[model samples]
Target: MKKLFSCILCLSLMVCIPVYAQDVDYSDEDYWYATCSKVQTSQEGVKACVGFQNYLDDQFNKLKEEMESYKNDLGSLQLNSSRIEELAKKQKTLSDSLDSQVKNMENQIVEINKEIEAVKVEIEEKQKEIDKWSDQISTRMINEQAGTGTNILIDLIMGSSSLNEMFRRFSGIERITASDQEQIEQLSDLKKELELKKDEQERLSDQIEEQKERIEEEKAFAQELQASYDQLAEEYRKVEADLKQKLQEQAAASNNIPSAGVISPSVEVTVPSVSGFINPVPGAYRSAGTWAYPGGGMHLGEDMAASIGTPVIAPADGVIIYASNPAPTNGGYLGNWTGWPYGGGNTIEMLCNVNGTLYAISFAHLAQEGFGVSAGQVVSQGQYLAAVGNSGNSSGAHCHIEVINLGSMSMETAISRFAASADFAFGAGWNTTATACEAGASAPCRERPERFF
Candidate 1:
């Protein structure tokens, strides 16, 4: 009866051990379990348990420090993101203004061309009048030199019936001379006016040409700015992707425990309950799963089309794992300085628990400085997250959402799988590539977001 009681006591003690401790190696009977068993109820056994607890505490503390460092980095990234959004908007505005100016200049040039044509016609008409007057003057001079004018004058005087008639003829000749002189003077004045008009036309033409050149220069500058914006956006995406990967690594690190040994008995663990997902965007939303590449690569996330500044909400209760501007850092690959995230734009990634499963939810292409949450922050379902925006590689204002099953695969793999199997509602026949996950590259495995929404 005493032996049986002792055995029962040992069995009860084993059951009391923590599930985490069951994996610890006690096979070397002479070391851990052997000493503990020798004085199972003594101070030495208590000391051993206390030592293990201390080790676990130390490990937890180290993980806490690492988490804090990651949080700080996330904060810095968010600040950068904010600045990038500002710079992007400024650059876009400048580009648009330049475009408008160019268009206005083009219209002015067209009008100037019309004016030049009209001036040319005026000058031609004046030249024709001048030519006609000069011809008349030359004919008169020739007639006078050839004695025709003298003969006419003598005949008129000799054949006159009275002095009054002769005086009338003389008056007629004087009037004719006066008219010719007036015509010559008018022609000369017209030539001067024509010359002035030509000069004015020349000036206008020069002005138009100057304006054209200026517009071209402005366009070139705008293009440069756009290119810079694109590069910065790429850089921002790369950095953001790197940060997400880091976060994943940090999570994996937190879960990784040193294998101590094996336990003969299995333990049942209970998982906490999770909530269902809700629509991330309120009101009217539209999507066609047309996440194709014009910006670069495949569209892994479904775009929820909405007006700019439309409110974005959390799909479920979760902690924000990643949030940042994802703006480029190289001043947009140009000598000019500007910044903004291009592809995903302002992004927020949350790790949600849905029906006891972990899901990584991403919100992309948000408005300028529109994020309402940050990394490590807890958010409730239907909570405001951001506003729809046309930032990044977007063609219009929309919110891009990607749901990744953390339990099944990486986000990238999940995306590829969904793309392969999902029905295309739009952008069909477009090429889709998973370069991010291919060739051993790390990326989030994305699932069909429509399934959850």
Candidate 2:
């Protein structure tokens, strides 16, 4: 019976030892790596792979969120820059206006001084005439008192030789008195005119001084605004530098992950009615559906598969706001490619207004040195814009187009409307909705090329 008990205990010990050997701490990095490495192409291996992918995806999402934050910061900085430019323009206008006003005031002051001087000279001449008349009257009064204590008119009439001569003498005496009276009245008018002119000059001077003070105030305010803008610009530069540093660090971290290339393509597509817009591409082309990329992010535009050297045209009348050769770098693949950092190669962003609504159209992945128009150039509907080619992160020759509503609609809504329009023109299956979007389960801001073609 003792030997039987011993055999049972030995069997129990063997079972317990195997269970202990099978136990694994999955949270440990070393253990996880070891287990995953040994996994073959089986159910267990697939599960392990999925788990690892999920972990990497989580990290990628975090980094993406950080990058988005930085992008928002950069957008704010751009807005600030625009504000500063607007303020500067306003300041220039104000300065010009003030300068013109100052010049006019100075001219008016000069004219007023000339008028005042003329009035002063006229007043001096009138005073001299008054003194001369007074002296004449005083000498006549003294002669009359010394000769006879009688009226000068009576004396003149009595001294006449005949009746006709007396009448003539009386007329002459009356004319002299009338002349002195006229001179006295003219002097009085001149004094009154001088006082009025001096008052006008004083008022004009006051107005000029007031205008100068206002201009100074306005100039000071403009200087203050400029200083504020400068400070804000400095602060924005510092923030931008910090954000760039953080982005570089996050990019380095993402590079360290091994499963960075495994991404799924699943999204929703829509169809709607066509409107006033026409197609941009005139020839044969295929729409590479939204979210068709394996990078697990919104394409933010529809890719049109076409042969190299295919002519790209403008869908509507618009002005080119941005046209440039993109930098030769692929941010996603970490390789030096001949294109933009975001893999769009040569790019153009145009602004078009339709039915009182502003829209921005972005064209990307054009052939190198194939741009037909430049920035600030206006192109009509169906005008040649560029040529299709495999530039940037393109797998083949294609044109990427993005339609952004510059109105009140959100990015998602604009994309949805664009997708519907494309579907109406090109039939269904042009766009789709997906869970693995930048907004996390929300619709992406990319539509099919048929919407604008």
lDDT per residue, candidate 2, 1-453, as tens digits?
224323533453331111111233344543443333331223344355336434534543554454344334434645353443344334333334434534544454455456556656765776676567556655653453344333445565566567876666556555545644565455455444444444444543554465456556545544554454344434333233233234334534565211211111121322221235676766746655444443333344577777767888878777665565653211111111333213456766665655545566777677765668865466787789987765654444577787654543332344344323321111111223332223343222333445546
Model 1 lDDT per residue over 368-422, tens place: 6556876456678888987777665453467777665555343333333323322
Q: After superposition, how far is residue 19 of candidate 2 from its true place, in Å?
A: 74
**TM-score list, all predictions:** 0.34, 0.31
lDDT over C-alpha atoms for residue 284 of model 2: 44
Off by over 4 Å in 2: 1-275, 294-297, 326-341, 408-449
Per lDDT, the best of the predicted structures is 1
Candidate 2 has what TM-score?
A: 0.31
Report, for all candidates in order, the number of backbone clashes.
15, 7
Q: Model 2 Cα displacement at 139 (Å)?
A: 99
- Look at candidate 1 and tell me the lDDT of residue 400: 73
